[model samples]
Target: MPRSTFHRILSPLLLWRLRHINDRVYLILMSVLVGLAAGLAAVLLKTSVHGAQQLLYSWVPEEKRVFALFLYPIIGVALTVLFTRYFLGGTLSRGIGPVIYNIARQNSIVPRSKMYSQLVTSFLTVTFGGSAGLEAPISVTGSALGSNLARILRVSRRERRLLVGCGAAAGVAAIFNSPIAGVLFAVEVVLSELSAPFFIPLLISSATATVVSKGLYEGQPFVLITNSWPVQAIPFYVMLGLGTALLSVYMLRVYFRADDFFERWPGTFRKVVLGGLALGLLVFLFPPLYGEGYNIVQALLAGKPEQLTDSSIFSVYRDENVWILLLVATASMLLKVFATCITVGAGGNGGMFGSSLFTGALGGFVFARLINLSGLYPISEVHFIVLGMAGTLAGVVHAPLTAIFLIAEITGGYALFVPLMLVTSSSYLISRYFEPYSVYTRKLVQKGVIVHADRDRGLFAQLDPLSMVQTDFMPIHPESTLGDLVTVFRHSTRSIFPVVDAEQQLVGLVTVDTIRDALFDDEHYNTIRVADLMAPPPAIIEPGDSLLDTLGSMDQHGAWALPVVNKGKYVGFILKSAILAGYRRQLLKESE
Candidate 1:
């Protein structure tokens, strides 16, 4: 062979071999990078929001301290209006739907356009005075980093999906300094798949991110919880869990409804501008709702429980104003829901996790007050606050394990595990029973994406590929002429046919549509070979491969049907319909 010919073959072969060996390693390294980036982004975004708020406060005269409080929302609304209008294509963005869509369909490539939009919008949402949190941007940034990195390395579609999860896990782990929680959140909330193939990478990425985050922030827990409450709180925890679950479902519904209503507006920018104006006015009246509510949480934890009140238009002071806090917390909870819906529904970019936490805290406070009235051992309201946080999150995300672990990690204690687990589990179970979907899955389902998993493993194990194989499949040979192909396909019952060489080596695939298209061309009247019309080798599946994996591959490719080849020889085929019917059959059998 000539040198050029030899080199061409050799280059691809070497690259392919090297890629096969190095892809996993590259994913691991990128995971670490995502973790670090997410950690830094969270910290910087948080600081910028606070610093801006402080600077705004300073600009006002000391006599205008209370006036400045209302001004906080004005600042947030103005900046958010500018950013959302100019940067986000004038649409309110929400959660990780775009990221998930890209991962599932577009190979996880997030445009820098959307990436920056989320970063700025989320910052303004929380910092400028929106009743949301930074967690949305953190997850988006992490997924974007992984997607961009994976694209650079030319990773496979499956690996790209895994990387999205890894990056998300890393972001969560770093933000909360809870590796296990991060991993579980990735598995349970993000991927929504529990599989051996994904666990290792998710775990490693989360652990790495947590370590990296700790290095930068000195390993402080996110919530700074210190408690030695007795185990008697389990029953109350259950109540808290169930209550939070019901409340989360209600909030999610309202949020989506608000989003729908806003989107129905005649114009995009007008709706957003109007929403911003409304938010400005509301925050102007009730200024403490201006940010992520972290400062509010701190105040509550410091024993100023009296700050909660029934008024709708007062500032959230750092001092414990129980009545004020009650009013603000309840109003804040409702307003946060609406703000999130408007922010995303109006095309402002951001996430819901942060809002969920804030809502949980509010719900917890309410629950605690109710319990206190019942003469329960005066458990600190802060304790109820923590439970409410986890319970609500668990219901919203539908990930009890992740929720419980996150609470423990965020609070820096396993001491509350009894209550945490009880509440989280109950909330998750209740939410799932009512809706049968998490926020992520609901978005995916809306987009017509199917989430396939190995839930019915025993059915798969018992199934024989041959049993599901189509009895009659169209076939063609390399030597077959155009006329021969036409003749065979004309009488064929099947829509598709597998083409093979004389030696029966798997060659290509052709369909009746191809034959018809060819007939419209002058080439069909000549002696063109069957190989000429056939596609390149089809996606072949071996006998030993799991049926679930085969099904996933077919679904991933949207293949109408796939050829099953054994040792390069055509064996059988499986239709998509059969797979679906088989799934139904298995479900019936299990029910029986």
Candidate 2:
């Protein structure tokens, strides 16, 4: 149906609902609906990717599969680029970063195109052997759904943002079948602030989405056969945590550097050709780097590390020595980030969420195998494999709680909860010390985009400093006498006046107190120029300055207002009172 027609049909029902349903009850209903839609979107993307992979590779012979792997990613990335260029207007934002940005800067309003753009592009990228994860794309799709749904319902900005979080949580829950982890992800990563009221909606949305996914899809992503985690492995877990933290930092730095290099490499065609070929060569050398690599994680969890080399040239060396397998695993883990960067930087649509897990599993497997070979102790490779995933996820995303519960819930047990807590916390603290922001937030922070997890900073970011610029203060000429200043002051409501030159550049400020003594003496009214009565302002503000920085300047100078100057010209003054009032209005809006 057309949008106008749809709105017309639902207008009466919406009015009835507003009269009969309270806000809390309406929010619950909206959460369930959004969850269901988000779940279906996730299920559709996963199924399409699986189906495409099967259709493309199911007919190929095992002996010649290596050749197919070399050709598929190039074709996939090319197709993705073509689709994005022709169909999506040559722009597609893939990952959780854009979604977080929308919430922070765009009033939680996601573009309608995002609801389907990510699904189609990510399907082509991942299904055709692109080394990226569908989780981020699906989450973006879900967030778009929630945001647009709130738009249709004509809800307040606060409620719309909540719905956005609901959709994101639902997507995560449906993808992993871990509702608790989904809720935590929304709190830790998406929502700027969390309160008691947010819990019920988040829980309801996540659980509902999980139900929809389970009803349509079967089986978990990875199955863990381990029953218990030994206490003696605590030392190994600690070491593993430290190792994953360092690895997380390495992955973030390498991915960003490679992405930047590709960005500066000039032509799009060159990037596609060179990046696709490079990615294909990497995947061809290490078969485990193909696609999301969840299958490798499953194989590792199943205690069959040999399978990683099944379709590779390293297959011949798989059984020669345990050290050979370790070498291949180490190489694969180190190079996975490059493959992911090429896939994305070359126009593939996907995220690093799965790459981190893939590298972590390999890192954990290598760590455990080396320990056993040392003849010092025997550790469960399975336990460390799982712990490695949690540790790296915690460090990479900077959300330790989400990592802990996600691993625990997906593994179908909290058997490793003790070790998970120890490892994830350690990794998070260490990673945070080295890299303050997560992979999703690092570039956004560097570009001065508002991606804060703190409530005050987030709220203040929503208040634009330029909008509060007060142009009501009368501009006075520097050559004006005290008689002219008295005439302007009588007609002006403000206590301060800006003295400007011929070019409208602010020279100084003249306040009521600055000329209090001059007002009583009219003998020198024509003698004393306005330049003699004015003094330099305490501080100057720019149009692009942040509210927090403006507040800091105001506090430091003990000034109630600061002149807003841009490009050597005076615009107006920004009063501290306006900022406080705007902040209070924002706070009240969010509370509602």
Candidate 3:
């Protein structure tokens, strides 16, 4: 049935049910439904990608797989571009970044098309080896599912936002089969605020999603069968923490630089040809850099680092010297970020979540191997490999708790909790000291969309400055005499009047104080033009300015009101009282 027809049939039933049910109880039921849907979406994406990969490569022999690696990424990216352009309406927003942006700036309302756009595009990108991850795309899809469902049910905006969080939590939970991690991810990464009331629904959603995922998908992403970590390895874990922290910073800088480079290219075809060839070359050189690189992580965890070089040109060199294996692992870890950037920047849909994990696994392997080779320590490579995943995840995303729990849950135990806390905390602190924003939020912070660290600035980001502009203030032409200004001021309740030219461009402001003395002098009122009495405003606000910027200008100029101009034309004045009122109203809305 058409969506409109379906909604028309379901709307009355839902409305009647809501009238008879407690809202909190109703929300729990909705959370369960959202979780099931999000989990199914996650499973669908994984199955489709895995199926496509097997179909593509199961037929190709091992010896000639290198040739497939060189050609598949190019084709995958090209197909993704075509699909996005023609099928997805010429644009597709990929990754958790856009989801967070929607929550912060778009009133938590995700586009309806996002329910399937990222899934299809990411499948095309990653299935044939675009060197990216599926988690972000699926999370975006899940968020969309929640948002659109709430819209269809005619829920309040606050309830819609909560469901969006539920959907995101479900997606992460389903993808990794880690419910606690999913809830934490929703709290720490997706949702702006956390309260006791949020936990029950989040838990319900995450647990439900995990159940759905486990029922259908049968394996964990990584398996660990290690004993408790040795006390003597504390120092080595500390060193690995520092190594992962540095690697996190390096990846962030390089990924953005690569994105910038790709953005400079003129057109989609140019970006695809250039980025595809470069990515294919990198994958050909290091087969471990192919796809999400989870297989490489598996090899590392299983103590088979040699398997990393199995399909590469360096396969022969793998048996010759241990240093060659170490070199390949190190190089692949460093280059994984570039491959990810190229894939996404060249029109493929993916995110840095998996790449960060891939880099961390390799870094841990290389770190442990070096120490063992030096005859310094015989630490458990598996422990470091797992811990490295947590370390980089914490550092790159700045979510230490999520990193700690995700690793613990995915590994089937919390055996490494002590070291998990140590490594994740250290890596997160070090990475934050160098770069204030995470990989997902750096550009957002630069563009002033949201300030992740400050609740006040974040709230300000959500309140649009344009919404508070006081257009009721009368505007007077610059050529108008003081008598004309007096006429506008007498009829208007505002204490300030904008002086505009014939073209409607704002020239200056005429405040009551500026013309106070001349008001009583009838002779001077006729002789003194409005332009002569008017003074330039201390500051001007743009239509796109955030409330934070607007308030900052108000504070800086000590002005009770400021004029808003767009392309030199006067839009209106924004008063301090009006902003405060809007803030109070926003707070009330959020509380409700």
- Give the range of the ten consecutive residues with the poorest summed lDDT in model 2: 445-454
TM value for model 1? 0.71
Candidate 2 lDDT tens digits, 1-592? 8978988998998899989999889999999999999999999988888888888887789889888889899999999999999999999887898888888878999999998999999999999999999889988888999999999887889889999999999999999999999999998888855788888998999999999999999989987765787778788999999999999999888977886787788878998899899999998998899999999999898878999888888888775678879988999999999999999999898988888889988999999999998977899888888889999989988889999999999986587889999989999999899888888887677655777547888889877777899999999999999999999999999999999999999999999987999997879989999999999998888877889989999999999999999987999999999999999999998777
Q: Please provide, for model 3 over 305-368, each residue's C-alpha lDDT reduced to its tens digit, 9 standing for 90 to 100.
A: 8998888999987757998998899999999999999999999999898999999999988898
Candidates' C-alpha lDDT? 0.70, 0.90, 0.88
**Candidate 1 ranges beyond 4 A from true positions:** 1-24, 62-93, 194-197, 218-227, 306-325, 452-592
Error of 2 at 409 (Å): 1.6
The alpha-carbon deviation from the true structure for residue 372 of candidate 2, after best TM-score superposition, in angstroms, is 0.7
The deviation in Å at residue 182 for candidate 2 is 1.1
* Candidate 3 Cα lDDT to native: 0.88
Q: In terms of lDDT, which candidate is stronger, 1 or 2? A: 2
Off by over 4 Å in 3: 2-4, 451-456, 472-480, 487-493, 500-507, 552-558, 566-569
The weakest ten consecutive residues by lDDT in model 3 span: 451-460
Residue 355 miss distance in model 1 (angstroms)? 1.4
Q: What is the lDDT of residue 391 in candidate 2?
A: 92
